[model samples]
Target: MIELTRDADVAMITLRRPERRNALDIEHCDALREAVEGATADGVRAMVVTGEGTSFCAGADLDGVYGEAFRESLYAALRATLDTPVPVIAAVNGPAIGAGTQLAIACDLRIASDTAVFGVPTARNGLAVDVWTMRRLVELAGGAAARRIMLSGELFDAGQARHYGLCDRAGDVVAAEEWATELASLAPLALAYNKLVLNSPDAGVEDDRLSAAFDACWASSDIEEARAARQEKRAPLFRGR
Candidate 1:
């Protein structure tokens, strides 16, 4: 239940399955992870994830996530996107609840429509959010705001989301497209490196993964193309090679 489209340098990944509010089933979650990874590997300069219909994502399908195995699998999908190299932008078109909010938080940037709402209602569902998602929520909205949402299980509207720093901006789908285009034009190498560095944990990170990500960019042709294109006063055509 994922839809993928490549326009210019932007890869738009839409969560389809509107009948279920684009809920995350095991297959949908797996497909989403693969779709995002595929887009990054295919040299997509930027990625925008949105959902179809009245809800951006209603969260995990209870039937799919109830089992222990499914829970683990769902967590894996969330972690994959959080650790992905390329920039990920979330376009919240409607209510982003539970795992829906988790997915948005995992992205590098969040642009929500004026009609959108965000919440972590795991407590409402008699459940709890994944550990990494909880940490990222704290990082996004700060301790006080995070506690307000998670502890009290409040469903905040788009304005509250912006106020709490849960989203970077609030507008319509058009605004999301515009923002994606602007971000896609940046030097891919620098953007990727910045994402890597900025995502570094406060505690610590494995040296091997950090070194590999850093070293890989230096060897990418995108770096030379970025410099050359800048010097020539033209836009760089990044192949992500």
Candidate 2:
């Protein structure tokens, strides 16, 4: 199950099936996708995803992991998170294994608690993640780390995750919330455009989409507001226009 809540401009999505270590099924994945899409559409400036009780997410429910519907829903949920305009911070509370790792990487940033652990041990279970998922792991943790995780099937603790660049910081939900609050106060248009460019497959490449976003940011009213705020010695109020 998925629980959606808002605190000012930050939306929180909590995975609620602690009994099963928050393992996701088709229904849960669908709900996650809906919640993320709805929150983005509703204009939430930032989002934090965490799990109830212990265990961020244990990955796909073993019973349904092989089903086509479950795979479809899981991918859909991940795509929704990746495509969200606002920033998403994954607050990894505990073990984030298999699909759980995928979900965390889908977010723009990851803040893991001291107790959090990460891994994608599909090789151990005779399962395999998709090309995109594998590439994402490589991008976050580097080729050597990714190889160790997938081939060796080893779980990495929070410290190791941070060292590998899979986790941005080691912190709890409160820390994640603090980060979300800071992100919410920044220029929304700039953040959205930057996130799009950073997450694009053609990042750092010349493209019309990237050029347009750059142009829009330069021409945005937020730029003037920033200048005025600097002169007034006050915080800039960005409308994201």
Candidate 3:
């Protein structure tokens, strides 16, 4: 249901169920969460998420799984992506609908292919995106764009997506993969800290948490290792603490 490949510092996670247009089922969602968590734990500095065939992800597997359990599993996969320390890049190769769109939005960056389209068609099925999911859309594309997409259950093409700031870049998969690798090559501490700060709440609530995270880096052996690696003219191996 999921294929995980490690390329240097980047882990490529692909949804392999093309037979169903890569519709997310319980097993597929579970596998995705596990793969993402495993990559983070294994010192992967970044990840690229894409689908195997023409469709990046077509949303929930209505024929395979539905109801509360399915929704919970989908939520878990998205939350895991958010919780990971390293960056997760969504390489949308095709249409991303419903839960599919949710997964892409959860990622730190979305790199869509020229052939890709993004749609949140939950309204078509009489479903509502959860609170956090709706907020994420608002955060990415702002309130007006979010309303236009969600309320109308409209599908936006790659160009429209770019206009709305839904995708950072739209290009070939190879290019997207290379971009992900470049991101993975950056300093792990800086990458994690940047993501933490970007997703943190207002200064009033984030000061303590941000300070603690920064302090942890200062206290970590990885900091010393980074210095030594720099002096030695080699890459630093960071063990996330």
Model 1: residues with Cα > 4 Å off, grouped in runs = 202-206, 215-232, 236-241
Per-residue lDDT value at 225 in model 2: 100
Compare candidates 2 and 3 on TM-score and give the better one.
2
Give the TM-scores of the predictions, in the order they appear: 0.89, 0.97, 0.89
Comparing 1 with 3 on lDDT, the higher-scoring candidate is: 3
**Per-residue lDDT of model 2, residues 1-241, tens digit only:** 8999999999999999999999999999999999999999889999999999889999999999997888899999999999998999999999999999999999999999999999999988998888988899899999999999989999999999999999998899999999999999999989988988888976665787788888889999999999999999999999888
Query: Number of clashes in every candidate structure?
Result: 0, 0, 0
Candidate 2 overall lDDT versus native: 0.94
Local distance difference test, each candidate: 0.84, 0.94, 0.85
lDDT of 3 by residue, 123-220 (tens): 77877778887888888888988887888888989998888899988876677679888887666776787788887645554587678778777877
- What ranking of all candidate models by lDDT puts the best one first? 2, 3, 1
Which residue pairs collide, candidate 3? Answer: none
Best by TM-score: 2
